[model samples]
Every structure is written in C-alpha cells, then in structure tokens.
Target: MFKSVDLKLQLVELLISSYANVDLSKVKIIGVQHILETTHSMFRSLYLLGLKPENIAIIGKCYSTCKEVFEEMLDDGIYVDPSSSSYCSHKSYDEWFSLNIENFLTSQIDDLLSGKYEKILVLDDGGKCIKALNKFSINTNLIVAIEQTTSGYEDIRYGCFNFPIINVARSATKLNIESPMIAQAASERLYLSLQRKGLKTNKVLIIGKGAIGNAMKNKFASNMEVVCYDRNQKTYDQAKVELSEIINQFPLILGCTGKISIPFDLHSKISPGTVLASVSS
Candidate 1:
C-alpha cells in the first residue's frame, strides 16, 4: 500500500504461496505497524493460510490523525478481523513507543504464559515489539521476529537477541527495489502538494544523502535544481561545512535523515515563507 499497488499484490501473492508449505497453526502471529493499512493484507493472507482467528493480532501503533482512518477501514471490512486483533492510536510517536507497545505486547505474552500458543512470531516496525520482547523472561516460545525498517534494524542491531531475527531492513530486495520506489513516490507527492499551493521552486535543499535522499535528489533534479548535504560530508569539505550558511538560500528544504537534521537554534536561520518537507516517518 505504501509503494506500487502491483508490487504489494505481488508480495502478498508470494507470501500466500510460501505459507502453503508452512505449519503456522500454533504460531501466534503478532503484527505491528505505524498504520494498519500495510498489515491488513498480511493478516488476511495468514488467515487464508488457515491460521486461526484467535491466534492472529494486527496491532496498529498509529497517530491520532490515523485513528479515524483505521476505524473506517475496519468498518469497511478491508481485512480479516481476527478475534484477538485490536489497535490504539496515540498523539505522539514517543508516547506509543514508551507506553503502549509494551502494554499491548504484555497482553499477548499473558496469553503465551497461559499456554495459548506454542510460539510467537512478530512482524515488527521500528523494532518496538522486539524492544518490548526484551522485557519478558519467557524466551523459549518467542521464536522469530521480522523487522521492517532500517531505523528499526539499527536500533536492535547491537542488542542481545535470544531468538533468530530476519533483518528485512538490510535485505537487498528492500534496499534496491523498495527504497527507490518509495523515495520516488514521496518526491512526487511533495512536489504535487507544493504545486497545489502554487508554491513552485527551482531550488531544493536535501539533507542526508542516503539512499532515499539520493533518489529524491535524482527525482527532483530532473525538473529542478537540487543540493544535498550529509553530516558525514561536512567533516570532509567546505561545501558541506555549515548548513546554517546556506539554510536560508533555498525555498524548499527536505529532510530525509531519520534523525534530527535541523537544530532548534537554526530554526531562526530559515527564511520567511520557506517550505520544509520531511520524508522521514
């Protein structure tokens, strides 16, 4: 749903085909995502594979703005709603991560402790479920986790793991195929949004020259002037010396850095009427 509809359909077909040979009857499937839309088809695929309704849970860790949309999708019966499935949206990302994730996973673990399922399989986003898993002592039944994002992989990479993890974040399929498509979609959306406002700009400043940033730069460069900066490059050359020196020059500034690319004090450096866009979650 995040990328091309064809790609999403192909992945779902692949997963459903592969699930035919697997025994997931006793494996409790727990899914976590920023939005419920991406995980809806996944839960449905598992159900089509004959996984029980009581054994599947697709929990959405979305924001307040998305709560209504989630409810509407459920109302529309967009996906198979298992008996154990539920979701809650918060006002901020930190609130959901620090408080809600562990609480939700704790309820699932309680079921595990009560001998409901032989094993737990997590579909994680942002590594929140894995981070929450570290708190429990019941490691034997927690078999595997699939992490979806690069930021999530980086967060859990140095941590001690008791079970096998599939790092889909670092997978070549995601890096080579998905990232560019996502970046291109993001770039076009931002450009179109600006166009609707009649705020056309020839120059764009892109922060963080990573895969997404580079792809976005290439996309924008086809029609506009684009300049990129990464923190890693600042130490090597004068051209990247200080973002503050050129912060006010560009009418459009895009942040693709996953971390904070602009400081609080530098907010004053941005010119009046400048448009700031973020491609990060």
Candidate 2:
C-alpha cells in the first residue's frame, strides 16, 4: 500500500516528468464517480500523470473514498478534502446531491478565477453543473469533462456550453473506450475465451458500419464465419455483403450499433445455444 507521503512524492515526480516533457501548467482535470472503485481508478491515473491533489476537485456523492485516496497520496498541506460526507453510497439522497454538486463546482470556479488554479477539469455532465459553469463564464484555460453515461454527453453538448469538452465515457464505449490497443485486446481476449469454451466457429453477426464494428469484423472474420448487418448502404456495399443475407444466414450474433435495439428475431431465429455478444458504444 502506498502511504500518504510516498504517493504524494510519486505524484509530484510524475507531474514534474510530464511538465519536463510537455506543458504541465496547461493541464487541469476534474471528474466525478458514482462508484468508489471507478473514482479510485480515475484519481490514480490522474495523480500518476502529475496532477497536484490541490489542483484537482471532485463533486459527487463518494466523498469518503475521495478523502481516503487523496489523504493517502498527499502530504499535510498538499491535499485537501472539502466534502462533508465521509463515505460514498450510491443510494438515494433526495435533492441534496444535486445542490451540493453545484455548490462545489461553483466554488471551484471561483478558485480558478482568483488565480488559484489555471486549468480545470469538470467530471460530471450534469445539466446544472454545466449550466452553472457556463453562466459564470469560468475562465478555465483547459477543461476535461468526464461522464459515464451517454445521456450526460447529450446533456452537455446540447446544454449550450461553449467550452471545448472531452467526455470520458466509462460505462459505454461511445465515450472513453477509444484506444485501438484496448479494443483489440478486448476483442482478442473475448474471442479466445469463447474459443476455449467450445465456441469456435461461432457464427458471429455484427450490426454496424462504424470503426468498432469494422475492427471486430477484421479481427473475428478469419476465425469465425462472420457476417455484418449494417443500415449504411455504403458500408454494406463496401463490405461486399448484403444485410439481409447476413441476417438470414447467421445465428450467433454481436451488436455494435450503439443503439439498444437488437436486429432480427434473436430469440426465435438463433439456435438455443448460440452465443450473442454486443460491442455497442
């Protein structure tokens, strides 16, 4: 376990390394998590990247977890936990959460404008928080937005915030799971795991024309008799395969359309033991 002083030094070293290589003064990050585990991971990554504990702010329900992590990492004056709650429970908390979240973010904005911090990272995609930031016209040089849900992205995008936003969607691929390495590794691991369980030659059906679907198709086509069903006529034409033919021919299916609807009568047409996988955004 990394003690408070050790972690703080590590963070400082990481930041110095980053600054030496790039520009640290230009980077700021903010994030929120509904779960403790997710929050831990996000903070760990950010700290390891050289962000000071004081420069970071979190606004969510899990105050206890944040406190523990930050306290363990930072020295006496380096880190501070301003949340009232000690523990994080995703359980219901009447309207207080929303109010508190807004208050916390608004306060942070004040700190930023007072020259307390240069860069800012907003973690939640909540309408109110985004609106608050926008209304105040916070002079944050850089803003990194992290959200777990697709609805959050829509909220921020359509909420009329003019800032440059980067949404780290953790819950769905449509947000954070973007790296080709992670995608390829996940695909390979899933494919191999399925193969080990006597799922080789599983008729994998994909339903999308996007990059992820294409990557899946390219990776799984050689091993399994893969078929793609896409509404994009251009993609269908380019693939040299018809959607109807693919739907009629394959039973084991994988969906990548980012939409919730599953194409074809999966229950009626697919074999009873057929495997189905969804890699949607």
TM-score of each: 0.81, 0.51
Over 101-162, each residue of candidate 2 has an lDDT whose tens digit, in order, gives 65676666656676555566666644435555666666645554555444456456666565
Looking at model 1, the pairs that clash are none
lDDT of 1: 0.70
* lDDT score at residue 91, model 2, on the 0-100 scale: 35
Off by over 4 Å in 2: 1-18, 21-28, 32-50, 54-116, 123-159, 166-179, 195-197, 231-249, 259-272
Error of 2 at 217 (Å): 0.7
Cα lDDT of model 1 by residue, 85-115, tens digit: 2333433445435466666666666766666
Q: Return the clash pairs for model 2, or none.
A: 4-72, 15-50, 29-121, 30-121, 31-123, 64-86
The lowest-lDDT stretch of 10 consecutive residues in candidate 1 is 79-88
Quote model 2's TM-score: 0.51
